[model samples]
Target: MKPQVILFDLDDTLTESKQKVSDEMAQVFSRLLENNKAAIVSGAKFEQQLNQFINFLPKDSNLKNFFSFPQNATECMTFDGKIWAKEYSFSLSNEEITEITNALNKVLEETKIIENEISYGERIENRGAQITFSALGQEAPVSAKKTWDPDQIKRRDLQKRLEEIIPQYEIVIGGMTSIDITKKGINKTKAVNWLSEKLDLPVSSMLYIGDSLFPGGNDAIVIQTGIPVMETKNPKQTTGIIDSFLKENVV
Candidate 1:
């Protein structure tokens, strides 16, 4: 069945980790937006989303049909033809940020995983609504990020430790080398539910595609929303999925 809207996860599903959207992907994705409503939900900040994905799209693309749920959907942004506006945001308090960051630091010290590694940038970032810990640092190369945690064992271990330290916030593994934390109940599921109400469509009318749908993965939370999902391992697989969507007479 054709969906009223299609939702996507950004990092590995739509593009490489922390990389810009490809020309071919932008073309196909723009085509998809012409007739279908689409949304990108990621743990990335709004600036990263624009720099990595939104900036690559053709200017003529249908911005009205596109939505961005950055910071693990703790914030939502939509285009208003002339400008992108925030529909809603759930920002963290300064106290909450401090607590989360402190917990992250404690866990990192206990694990000592960073002792021998070369970090690219800030290891922990306060993204307003969400705090993210990128194991190899925020600006780590894609090759390094991919090779650092192919099995997610290291991140899962870290996530376990962080959860124990800060039990009030939501923590999940995302991308290749990042752990994202948000307020309890603030997640991709909330984003989809918000969009469903905004569009006056049922949750079942949307389709989600992502790379991390396994248990404990960030994308796994959306499964609770009962939206149909297609899992892809990488951007290439995601492109093929988009191609199939284009072949369908979806409107």
Candidate 2:
């Protein structure tokens, strides 16, 4: 049976990290919404989603059929034509945010990996319910970000240290050069389950596509939910995956 909804990871999977979605992907996305519901789940904040993908969607695309899971699924937004409204959002208290910040500082100080690295924009951002540590800065060029941690060795070590220091929070490697810290149990799987319940579809009727499904990758959590998954290397391959899906199932 065809999937009731298609869930996608934004960075790497749908487009280059922090890059706008291609015109080709936009057309394919609009076509996708013609027959099925679709959702974008990313570690990015809502504005990133807006600039990178949502803004490029076809004008006539059915807005109601789309969902946005930003901030590592800590927040969910749905389009209501005029604007995107919060379906739900989880927030951290001031004290919790402070603790997370302090923990990150302690980890960085102890690890000393990122301390000497040159950064781009803001490195640590508190996105309401989640705090992100973008190693090279959020606006760093994709080339720089890719080179920063190709083997994932650097980030995996960072994540391990973070987990030890901030055991209360869920920490995961995100995007190319970022670490996501969210409240416990809040990850990509949370978004997938929420969509399953809201759309009244079983996990078996859903498919998740992402670039990072390997162990410890941000998108890896969805694997625990028993949803079908496809791994794509980049946006070009993602377009091909969508095209094939449309051919096989859109009729």
Candidate 3:
């Protein structure tokens, strides 16, 4: 059956981590809005998604059919041709934000990982609804980020420690070198539920695509919704999948 809504992960699944969406992928993605309501559900903030992907889409693309779920779905926004309008946000309070960042700093200090490694920029970023810790720094080159935690061993360890320190928050590995933290139950699955309900589509009528659907990855939580899922290795594979979906379902 053809999906009524198609959701995507913004990083490696849609484009290279932190890289701008290429014209090829943007064209394919624009075609998706021709048939289905599409959304980019990612751990990055809206600004990141705007710069990386939305800005590359064709001017004729159907903006109303597109949704943005950034900060691991803690925030939702939709485009209106002129600007993005917020649908909702699970913003953190100042006290909660301070506590989370303090815990992150303590973990980094005790682990000595950040101290031993050569750093680039601010490692911890506050994204209103979520706090992200980039193990290699946010502005690090893709080559450096890719090599930092290919197998996710280091991040898993950090996650375990962070979980213990901040049990109230949700912690998961995201992108190539970042760990994302949001309120418990406000992960990607929340966005899935919201999008499904907002569109009046059942879980069976939606499809999710991501590189990190495996257990412990950031996108893993989405599988709990029981929506049909397709795993892609990279943006190239994602483009091919979109092309095939359109071809098979063409009217």
Candidate 4:
């Protein structure tokens, strides 16, 4: 089961919440490259995640790859810091974005959550085509976010309710409080499967590391395709799982 390719989830798996890769995580990635190249599969925009981890990884390794901008992002590169093959992204009109934002804004005003809701990260992202709804604004506190949607029950309910009002949009739960709204095909599973096919690897040969795998979690659908999944309890523990997978398969 030696992985020809290893894919990592950016947030909470390789790094702390809404933070850059830690020195310790960097070391693990370095180890991964010694035998097999690794790729990052994330819901963040392609440029955003790359900006976060590029400094940590060796730029000379052409084997390194990344899959970013989940749903709307379609480019997969061979570590040139650029993509060779870009899958198409579904986009929404400016009016659509404005309307959605306005609705969410109204909700925020009514609930008065905006005052207490400290934005820890980036939200309202335009991945060339898809749109996101990041609760902590992409930089929110993990403890606060957990408190925001303890079981993701609230988010799921919100998604269903939103769909009733805006049936035209496709809403998918993201790595954090964010929600990805795009065309029907915009999902991490499709992106991962596409990358696997392009790499000539099977779903089983590749292990996907992600934090949000619970019901209505973003990475949950990615697991639905029969891909072998390595669930990460925390970023600090990711190295251990990666080590075990590498040892179990490579050794």
- RMSD in Å for all candidates: 1.5, 1.3, 1.2, 3.3
Better of 2 and 4 by TM-score: 2
Instruction: Report the number of the highest-lDDT candidate.
Output: 1
Candidate ordering by lDDT (highest first): 1, 3, 2, 4
TM-scores for all predictions: 0.95, 0.96, 0.96, 0.79
Winner on lDDT (3 vs 4): 3
Instruction: Give candidate 3's error at residue 215 in angstroms.
Output: 1.9
**Predicted candidate 4 versus true structure: per-residue lDDT over 78-129, tens digit per residue:** 4444544454555677887776666556554554544666786565666655
Q: How accurate locally, in lDDT, is each candidate?
A: 0.91, 0.89, 0.89, 0.66
lDDT digits (tens) for residues 101-192 of candidate 3: 99999988888877767667879999999999998787989888878888999888889998998899988888888899888878999889
Stretches off by above 4 angstroms in model 1 are: none
Mark the 10 consecutive residues where model 4 has the least summed lDDT. Answer: 64-73
TM-score, candidate number 3: 0.96
Candidate 4 collision pairs? 74-87, 120-139, 120-140, 121-137, 121-138, 121-139, 121-140, 122-137, 122-138
Off by over 4 Å in 4: 62-78, 81-88, 93-99, 102-123, 245-251
lDDT of 2 by residue, 120-175 (tens): 99899989989999898877888888789988898888888878888989888888
The 10-residue segment of model 2 with minimum total lDDT is 242-251
The deviation in Å at residue 244 for candidate 1 is 2.5
